[model samples]
Target: MRVGVLTGGGDCPGLNAVIRAVTKSLIGQGQCEVMGIEDGFQGLMEASPRVRELTWDQVSGILHRGGTILGTSNSANPLRDDATKALVSRNAKALGLDVLVVIGGDGTMSLAHGLADVGLHCVGVPKTIDNDIAHCERSFGFDTAVATVTDALHRIESTANSHHRVMIVETMGRHAGWIALEAGLAGGADIIVLPEIDYDIAAIALRCRERELRQRYTIICIGEGAKESGASLTVRERVEGSPDPVRLGGVAHVLRERLQPHLKSEVRATVLGHLQRGGDPTPFDRVLATRFGHRAAQLVLAREWGRMVTLQHGEIGSVALGDVANAQRTVPLDHELITTALDIGISLGR
Candidate 1:
């Protein structure tokens, strides 16, 4: 059997771990050849696709690596162009691929579903740092991203205390606020703002002022998608032809400006943009990626097409690609973490 592999969407930690596991598992079986697809689906559109035979030696010592060896792209959707879609199918046949193992977030999984509709066998492995894939308890890179954000928050807290200022740390989360919620609770942030709930500027400002009165600096954690009650603060305009064009950002800057009038201390915003996406994979992420990869390999051997590997209840499992594609799992309002944060007097800007 000849199997093709590619990574897509925003690059994340532990991607190399999944690739390593897939290549090593297939090679160990002694019955399959693994091909690496470069730059997501764009490789398939090339007249001479950019591909290289993957071997055990090539995958060794890559478990701790951050990015994907095969590379990735967020904007290459074959479905957008009929010629490109045909090229992808022809290229897969030219390479004699029996199946394609796609490791990516929601966007890539949706594309895999589309490819499968056109007679290409696809197996998906979830790989988002946001932990927002529907029906899955966790994804590979979420742990590493949370750890990075928590560490950054700790550092920001120290500086805010020393300077006697209100520091707002912005994190990435397009539709979900898992990163901000978990990191804020773990880092002991005084105010936590999430996209799931609209924030009240006056409440956040009052919290900052109260903390100032107690001779304490304030630390605020805000998700990039966080919005005011009636408006959204965006840093960039939507791209005309992009799939996800509504870029949610600049909320921290908006907060800093609005809260300044209510607080006597200095207010500043710090955007931790791509820092959460890069860096070495945490131990948990490495193990989880390996498990997901191995499960995908098993699915291939079992001829289970159009399925996505998922983590549920601390165990690796599989679900239908149709079920997961285009579905986002956002943070729930009545979650235990939210209650815990509220109990600890952490303002959620409500």
Candidate 2:
């Protein structure tokens, strides 16, 4: 069987590891041929699609790399129109691919499901730094992001302490607060705000004022999707031709602006934009991505088309692509982590 592989949606740290594992595992079999689909599903829509054969040598030395060698485009969605879908199907058939191994987040999985609807077989591997994919307890790239955010917070805390000021750090999380919540606790943040919980600026200011009585400085970690009480999410901008276009950002700056009036110390805002996305994958992500990739290849060999590899409760498994397509997993309000933070005297901006 011939298989095509592509990385889609926002590029993450473990993408190269997954690509490397998939190519090596399949090519080693000798019975299966692996092909690389360039620029994601957009490649399959082209009249002369961008592609290449994946040999063992081509995938060598990429396990510790940061991004996909095959390239990716988040803005291009091949399932946007009927003509585009037909073109994609025709191109995939012309390429002689029996199945596609799609590596991506929710948007890319949705595209894979659409391609399956058009009679093209696909297997999915979840890839997202946000760790918001449904049915999967953990996704690759999230560990690296959390590490980056935590490191940044540690650095920011020193500066805030030196200046005796309030510092707000914003992290990437459009709908879920896993990055902000986990990194905040790990970095020793005094306060944390998430999209799941509405934040009261006055309450945050009260905490900052109380801290000024003792520590004289406060560190706040907030998700990009977090909002003030009775207010909508802060949007950076909107992309015209993408599946999920509402860009969430600037909540830390919003928090700084609202909190400055109530606190005596100067307030500052820092946005860890894309710093969480770039850089090499952590050791945990490397192993997890490899496991997910090998599992996906197993599914392909077992003829488990229309399924996505998942990691749930420490087990590697598979779920239907239809079950995960366009689905999102957000942080629960009663999560143990939330309870831990509260019990540790961390303010949640409630």
Best by TM-score: 2
To one decimal, what is the Cα RMSD in angstroms of model 2 from the true structure?
A: 0.9
* Best-fitting candidate, scored by lDDT: 2
lDDT of 2 by residue, 134-240 (tens): 99999999999999999999999999999999999999979899999999999999999999999998888889999999999999999999998899989899998
Which residue pairs clash in candidate 1?
none
Report the lDDT tens digits of candidate 1 across residue range 1-350: 99999998889999999999988888786468999999988888689998989999999999999988888888778777777788888889999999999999988889899997557899999999999998899998999999999999999988999999999999998879999999999888999999999999888888888898895799999999888899855655675444455667778898888888887899999999889999999999999999999999999988998999998888888999999988999999999999999998999998
lDDT of 2: 0.92
Clash totals in order: 0, 0
10 residues in a row with least lDDT, candidate 2:
23-32
What lDDT does the true structure give each of the candidates?
0.89, 0.92
What is the Å distance of residue 59 in model 2 from its true position? 0.4
